[model samples]
Target chain A: MSHRSFVWLCLLPLAAVTVAFFLLPMARLVVTGAEGPQGLAGYLAILTEPRYRATLLNTVLLATATTIVTLIVATVAGMFLQRHRFPGRAILIAMLTFPLAFPGVVVGFMIILLAGRQGLIGDFSNRVLGEKLVFAYSIYGLFLGYLYFSIPRVILTIMAAVQKLDTGLEEAARSLGASPWAVQRDVVLPALAPAFVASGAIAFATAMGAFGTAFTLATNIDVLPMLIYTEFTLAANFSVSAALSVGLGIITWLILALARSFSGSAVAAAG
Target chain B: MSAQAGHGASVRIEACGKTFADGTRALEPATLEIARGETLVLLGPSGCGKTTMLRIIAGLELPDAGGRVLFDGKDMTAVPIERRNVGMVFQSYALFPNMSVSDNIGYGLKIRGVPEKERAARVAELVALTNISGLENRRIDQLSGGQRQRVALARAVAIRPGILLLDEPLTALDAALRDRLRGELNRLLRALGITTIYVTHDQSEAMELGDRVVVMQKGKIAQIGTPREIYFTPNSRFVAEFIGAANIVEAAIENGHLVLPGGRQPIDGDANISAAVAMIRPETIRVLAAESAPLSGVIDSVSFIGDRQRLVVSGVSNRSLTVDAPNTVRAKSGERIGLSISPDAVRLLPPER
Candidate 1:
């Protein structure tokens, strides 16, 4: 076969799988939400309802909070891992990345065991501080669970970026009479800005779309994912569920677009 | 220039050494002095601790043993790199990629809190001094190698540093560009009158640019002198061999004459030792016809160089000697040729200790 045909054959399976499992299902969901007997009324109802609105806002708020926290912690951790070489550096890196290997549900269960009301530190806080530390069923609880998984992903991405940076820039800044703090601010941070933005986007998208952890930890507060799950399984409203899913997808895409725009300038600056 | 001549700081180093944690001795105890407004070139082979010495002077690397780096009669041993006010041009031309050419040159001024208008004027002056005025808006990545080198030089001098350290700054350029820049750099440095220390493995560069050359080997200063002293009258066999291509022949002093395996010649200097290596320059060897030849050898090979022809002659004792003659002298391989050298051209270097 010709080279073009060979490449086409190699990509045929991925194309088939995407069409079969992803595009078809999404198209069907959108069509059903628009052309059903209610015919877009279900989407309107979900959008107009105060409960759904609150749930959407809460989901966005939680995703933003988780993203900022993950970015700050992961960037600092990545800088440490990249710059400082110590005896346990490799072990520390592997431990930070250990969450990526575990399924989201398993991570949720682990977080529950550590921070649930009856759990280890939760129980200790209750007894010692005379306050009940409840993290199982609130937005805060969902964020904690999401953080367990997202922080590691952010760290790995940012760490790779930091490692690839040219150390000569920092030395140049120092040689130019810049203080240590000034070197970090002007040279190192600007160099790492693109990676920071990219990793933040990934963290935010992952936190927003996380269902397994949210489902496992939901109690009184209902995020968008939980509401969609309830609408699909309990209320048997597939159309509404699909609409919520599409909304979440749009939000994530918008965030990713902003990230690309911001990081483009950063990459240019680095070059 | 007058101020520098009268009151500029001179660099004084005493007993400085550096040993890494891995026990690798990068620099042994070294002592030297650099006069104000004099350019000293540190020349050595690779891994000879030249770069390490430059770093120690720049305060980037500290010595492990006892040493004092006195600048302008002030002890600067404990000062950090930033406070030392020493500008360095690294081998890699470590320009900040995020900054434009003008900004890179002005960075030190900005860090020193020079006002914006003055910094801009100084940057413009340096850019013109380095002949890179049109490249002010160019980024480092967008510049050619020579342009980047000029930018680096401009940046180093923009701050008017007390001392300028260059770590093989011209080694990265093409040969043609390197030669051109060498003259330009000499002119610019002479005009600025900055105390500069240039490090390189190229001997010709050291000879051409330095007021004094410090030849190093194995973490020690082998010899330090003027270019003529180091090249023509080396103190030791290592210095002679390292500085230039000199033919070393073992000879003995007997009856007020130097006796070699092939010939006998009168000795010029006092010969206290029994045996020494006769250091002969290729240009000093004269190829004569067989009848009047002092030593006879068969020409192994002859090649035409740009200005002269070089002949590799193998003596009957199997000792090979190189001779440079005018291109007009035609000699072929396997031909018997006579070699003669004047006693004054024969330098007796001390035996390798």
Candidate 2:
């Protein structure tokens, strides 16, 4: 065969796998979304119905909050950990990243162990305040679980970026009469914008699509993933769940794209 | 320009030494003084602590306790780099990639809270001064290496700093660009007339730019003198070899003449010394007819350099002697030549430790 044909032959397996596993399933999901009595309006039901809209809003807000907080915590921690050398630093970093190996259900269980009704926080609060402050079964517990895993991913990327930072840039700033805070504001933070966008997108997408943590927390928690699971498995509402799934995917992708474009302009402006 | 004149601060570093946390001593306790509006070069090979001394002066790294840095007689030992108001240019240029050329140059002014209009005027003035006028709005990455160098220099000088420290500013560029920039930088420094400390390993750069050059070796200052002084009257073999090309001859002394294997070479030194280490600059030795001069050697190889021809002459001493002959003279390998060197041209150095 010619060179072009040989190149095409190499791509054949990837084409088969994508068509069989991804494209076909996606096309079926879209078609099945409109097979209900509401027809094409079944996709609109995700936005028009009060219950589905609230769950969608809750999921978006939780994911957004998780991403924002994770980025803040990780940037500070990563900068410190990457710059300073002290005893126990390696073990500290290893422990921080240990969450990456955990499944979402395990993260949820850990949160419950800390904040559940019979857990440590509740026990302490009951002894001190004469009240049991339990939040493990609520959306807060799922938020904590998402933060636990999201932090490790964001921190690792930030640390890598920090390691690659030209220390000369900071010194040059200082030589130019920039105080330490000014150096961070004017030099270090702007240089890390690209890493923030890349890692923050991963955190946001993970939080949006995660299900096992919400499932393990409580059935009543109104996140889109849990709503879709109940609507498909318990109520047997395949069309609605399929439409919700498509909506979730599109919204997460759109937000990430929006973030990328926004940071792109900022990076260019910085340059 | 008038305001900047005499604004240069005379720096006096008193016994500054640096020992790292790992117990590696980066610099020996060395004290030096730089006059106002003078350029002092710290020249040495890599890992020779030139950069460490520069950092000590820049306040980037603090010296050991009791090692004080003073600016114009005022002690500034505890002051940080930012508060010390010293301008610095790094080897990598370190131009902020996230900024435009004008913004990079004007960053110091902005940090000082210079108003927007004044900052813009200063940036534009520096843009014109550094010969990068049209590149003001362009990003740092858009500029070539030479342009980046000019921007880095402009940024360092924008704040009208009292002292300027440069650590191998031209080292990252190609050879041709480095030479061209060296002249340009020399002119810029003279124009500014600021107290400047430049660090570089290139001897030619140290010779051309420094009013005084401090030759360093193994974290200690080997010699500190003017270029001519360091070249003509080097205190030791290390300074002699590090600054420029030299042929070190080990010979016995008799009647104040160096008794070489080729012939007795006259030197200005104590006659009673039994042996001595002498340094003769390559250009100082002249090749003549073998029968006419006191010293004679056989030419092993002839290299025709553009300005002058270099001949590797054997049988002059224990080792070969590199002799620079005039380009107009035609001499081939295997020719016997006499070497004529003046007494004053031979510098008798103390024996190596």
Q: For all the predictions, what are the DockQ values?
A: 0.65, 0.86
Taking chain A of model 2 alone, its TM-score versus the true chain A equals 0.95
**DockQ measured for candidate 2:** 0.86
Query: Among these predicted structures, which one has the highest TM-score?
Result: 2
lDDT tens digits, residues B175-217, model 2? Answer: 9999999999999998889999999999999999998999999
Model 1, A181-216: lDDT tens digits are 999888888888888888788888887778888767
At residue B262, give the lDDT of candidate 2: 92
Worst 10 residues of 2 chain B by lDDT: B1-10
Cα misplacement distance, residue B242 of candidate 1 (Å): 2.2
**TM-score, one value per model:** 0.92, 0.96
Model 1: which residue pairs collide? none
Candidate 1's displacement at residue B74, Å, is 2.0
The local distance difference test score of each candidate is 0.83, 0.92
